[model samples]
Target: MAARSKVMQLFKALHRTRKEVFKGDDDALEAARQNINAEFRNNLTESSPEKITELLKFGTDVEIILRKTVIQGVHTDHNRISIKPRKEILLDNVPFNHNPTIKDT
Candidate 1:
């Protein structure tokens, strides 16, 4: 329960930051780009387009962003989803410990 709440909090923070950053923008491209960049820096390999498109269906349910043209079949489904950049951050906020074992030659 707490984990879900934490996730929601983080998303809310992200949305708030996004609105502030792009008040007049028609899309959330800038915010999405930043999120993706941050995710990449953290070594969170993002899923491919297949996954992104699957995600779009969910986004529609959430009413985040959608295009009427796409809905009307004027554009491809890929164009409908503006995939925001994503990063994989640990929920517990623990520092990663890398310990490699040495082998005798």
Candidate 2:
């Protein structure tokens, strides 16, 4: 996989979680973000073999901060409801046409 492709994949995965996995709830958003982060981190192992490894690591860390921001966006919620991990579910459903090995950058 190319670095650009990996980045696009990561963004798409995160975007999917933000749109589908999370509702307008605080804990749910946080949980969704966490799941997305975890999925990105896991995929980075194969997506970005060299250069993107560090980039994805940074992305994971930044995602933690972004998750907090998302939580804050829904601070009005009182029930503190959380969404289940949907990363695997989402990934499993997405069709992949290739198993191409990413070359080291």
Q: Which residue ranges in model 2 land beyond 4 Å of their true spot?
A: 1-3, 9-13, 16-21, 47-105
What local lDDT score does residue 46 receive in model 2, on the 0 to 100 scale? 66
Estimate the overall C-alpha local distance difference test score of candidate 2.
Answer: 0.58
Residue pairs with colliding backbones in model 1 are 36-85, 36-86, 39-87
The 10-residue segment with the lowest total lDDT in model 2: 67-76
Poorest stretch of ten by lDDT in candidate 1: 66-75
lDDT, candidate 2, at 6: 59
- 77 in model 1: Cα distance from truth in Å? 34
TM-score of each: 0.28, 0.33
In terms of lDDT, the best-performing candidate is 2
